[model samples]
Target: MSNKRGKGPMGFGGPMGGAVHGGAKAKDFKGSSKKLLNYLKPYRLSIIIVLIFAIGSAAFSIIGPKILGKATTKLFEGLVSKVSGTAGAGIDFEYIGRIIIILAVLYLISALFSFIQGYIMSGIAQKVSYNLRKEISIKINKLPLKYFDKLTHGEVLSRVTNDVDTVSNTLNQSLSQIFTSFTTLIGVLIMMLSISVSMTLVSVLILPLSAILISFVVKKSQRYFKEQQNFLGHVNGHVEEIYGGHNIMKAFNGEEKAVKEFNELNETLYNSAWKSQFLSGMMMPIMSFIGNIGYVLVSILGGYLAVKKTIEVGDIQSFIQYIRSFTQPISQAAQIANVLQSTAAATERVFEFLEEEEESDNLSTPVDINEIKGSVEFKNVHFGYNEDKIIINDFSSKIKPGQRIAIVGPTGAGKTTIVKLLMRFYELNSGEILLDNTNITSFKRSDLRKVFGMVLQDTWLFNGSIMDNIRYGRLDATDEEVLEAAKAAHVDHFIKTLPDGYNMELNEDASNVSQGQKQLLTIARAILADPKILILDEATSSVDTRTEVLIQKAMDNLMNGRTSFIIAHRLSTIKDADLILVMKDGDIIEQGNHKELLEKKGFYASLYNSQFENSEAS
Candidate 1:
């Protein structure tokens, strides 16, 4: 919890200056502070106890100088007596020893109380951070897909990681210090007043100067901190995007562009970071300088008062000590403005994310997937990512149970959007999709999703063993069942070729394997789940001809007796006697089996012929 970084007693982040965690600046301090208090409400009693210990500790610490002053005065008296050679003027070593003992006791008690307060504060800080992260994790599941579409994974991670960390560090380092510093300030003020009112005023004079210096620095630095945090998020997002697709970027000769963009973001982060750190770093030295001036003034005044016999030498010493203690807390109190500002900024980001619209409630009656057939019907479907423009306008379709429905279209022709609508990933503006005579909305989102298994153009695999990744589809599947699914999907052969076989661990992005092989692993997962309805969105688009043939054969086996919808790119892939919907500009331009559409010589024929001609030319 102590933010002390170097040899100085005063810690920069603790009391002397603002901490630049994530380089964030708070825009709305009051609002953020108010909301943050809501989280602390649960720990109100613990906070009060921390305050009590803090006050007790400072109170005991304040008494130490005073008690030591008494010892000093006694020792001085004894020295003067010895110099004058008075009969009963010998040094009262006994009394001085007793005073030293009492002072030691007071300091020991203060330290004990301080330690307890710090321990309690640490627990409170950690609990608050834990609760915050837990809520964010739950919120992620509830947020609608549109929210994720607009924001990068790194941007969200910034809020969850950097922002949360900022809050945690601030609470750990500053929260108890704020209370202790203010208590010390007040207790030291009282102690100084008791020693000499004039000396207290002299020490107090430096406060306004210290306040002005700290205010100026904090005002200059806060905006930079905010800029630093924003740029950091941008930098993180940029890195995540480039790293995720680094192979493709290298293939396309996009490394230069990626580097250029990264440099721009990094440079911006540097500019703001250095300025914020430099300004915050100035806080302690400036306050220390002002404190020194006050120290000089108090020393001179206290010396004068002692010489005039108005106050004892011991009193002067004690008052000077109190001044040192007093100014530190004042310096800390001044720096608190900056600390609160950073806190507010981080809290605002966290609250903003928490306040985003969650996915619509799945409060409708839950339909059991096992009770229904796989009949799917799209009735007058009208939808678009944007509300003002309708892309899939008045699109209607009906598919019989256990049929393989292939949807073919050019790029940007709404091929994938249709599947998204079917799974309720995006709600329709005005339309209804029924599965087995019941509106899809009638089922809970979880229940509806469980009935359908998906294998998309983009394959996602977690960092786990090959067996574990395959078993992800059906978590309870036995090892034998997992191997069976892999064999059915034609991935068992390649998996066996690996040194670790099914036990081989995948890397972070599963980049240890080829993209085509990754697709096969996903197919094995889908085969294992064995859902009633299947959605394959260009699942084989990334594989080679031979791999595609194997995948197609495995897919054919998987599609048997199951309702399957395939979004295909290769025209030759869907040549069998199954329904084929050729889409253009969000509308179904052609429909029928391969032979029927080819005989018609319509849009489907043209699309088919174009692909054949292009393939032949290549």
Candidate 2:
């Protein structure tokens, strides 16, 4: 999103001496700079060192103006006295020279201190960003599956990358400078008040007005910057979506439409940025104009007051010098206001994400595998994806240990939803799911899910070796065990034929493999898991006849001692199921063994008859 602050129109995030947001004044940052400052508490010594450097830098600034004032006063007074032929009109160039040398030494020391300050500030920024990045990474791991489903990958990606960088950049570019600006302003004001307090008052009369103008500009910049950031998020989301679905777009001939949408989003971002830039760019020049006006007022009035013997010429000169000193800080404060506001907006987004509720992690008291009996049941379950619509209405079923059950249903019939609910992906609206005669909710979510092995319709694989993918089922499994599982899934033969076999890298999503091989790999993973419950969904749909025969054999072996649930569109695959549940519109229309359901000539009968006739025709 747009981080457009007060700067002239240029490139985005490039090195162009960038500016900051307007809405968030240093005083009005939406998030706690105090919270960010807490990081310094851990390195108080470093903070003290940097503070000393900052003090030295401002001290030199104060001395530099004083030196120039002294030299000017000595030289001018001497020349005026010489013209008047007055006694004690002789110059003290040596003394003036000495004071000027002192100022030079102070400046040289200031440079050294400035270097040290830069180094320490950079260290602090990186250290703070490191901590934030680590904390965010850990927080992501704790989040539930649903959070990812709701927020786009780009949104989260921006948080981890763009947000972290903003925090770091604020520290690196602005942190010490902010300190210097503030201290210099304070020191200059203190000096100004000491010499011709009246002239100092005159010089500062326009100060409040300048501040108000800057504040107004900042407010406008902040509003635009906020909009810019939102548009940036849109741009990021669009690019990610298009890049992710490039192949899909090519297949559907939708490239032009995608590009059109992206261009539109880019145009919006550009407009928001340009307006924010225009407003922030006014801050410095406007403040400089006010400062120049202050100087002009002091020049006229201070000179008049000096002639009237109310103030010395030297005092008038000192007031003018201090005016120059204080103006820089005034301008800097304006820029800080802009920068701080934009950072706050970004911080708001980051912290908002961090505060989201994470999934509960609790392990129910350990269930000894030897003591557990396999039993599962669903009682009048009512479920929905959202509160507004129910997908599963009073669905009921019973599954005994070691029973082979098949669920048959068409699209939108809540077939997949049942499996998801059984796994507790989403809680049911109303009803109880029981495992071993105990309400499933009473079991820990992790512990409950640990009892099952699933092979889904779409296979998922990490970009890793074949052996590593299988080992994902059981991280502790040895290479030999992974090979054994592959053999069980009828995948070992294919693996042996490959150049690198199990050692080969699987590209993202395992796209290097055919659909049939991908299914086999998923079966291999499930085989390695070796859980007490097996769930298959569209398991053999992609495989050819020979491979399907081998997969069915492997599944039969896998189901020998475990409770299994299979959902298949291919009815012939489920003829041997111990029980077949015919589901339509979330209701169980009929259920029985293949032969018994056929004899009844009901919903299951018609479905079976049509499938059998189709097979015969083929």
Candidate 1 to truth, TM: 0.92
* TM-score leader: 1
> Cα lDDT of all candidates, in order?
0.85, 0.80
Q: 1-618 in candidate 1: lDDT tens per residue? A: 111111111112423444534344667888888999997999999999999999999899989999999888988988998999988787788998898888889989999999999898899989988999999999999887978988767568767776777688778878888888888888888888888999887777778888888888777876776667567667766776787677898999998988888888789879987887888888878877887887788888888888899999999888878888987776666566566776788899999999998887557457777786799999999998888888898889999999999999889888899999988899998879999989998888888898899999999999999999999999999999999999999999999999999999999989799999999999999999999999999898899999999999999999998899999988898887379998999999889999999999998899899999999999
Backbone N/Cα/C clashes per model: 1, 8
lDDT of 2 by residue, 116-197 (tens): 9889988988997788788789999778766787876756876777777777887887777788888888898888887777
Candidate 2 colliding pairs: 1-232, 2-228, 2-229, 5-20, 20-338, 20-339, 21-338, 24-341
**Candidate 1 weakest ten by summed lDDT:** 1-10
* For model 2, the run of ten residues with the poorest summed lDDT: 6-15
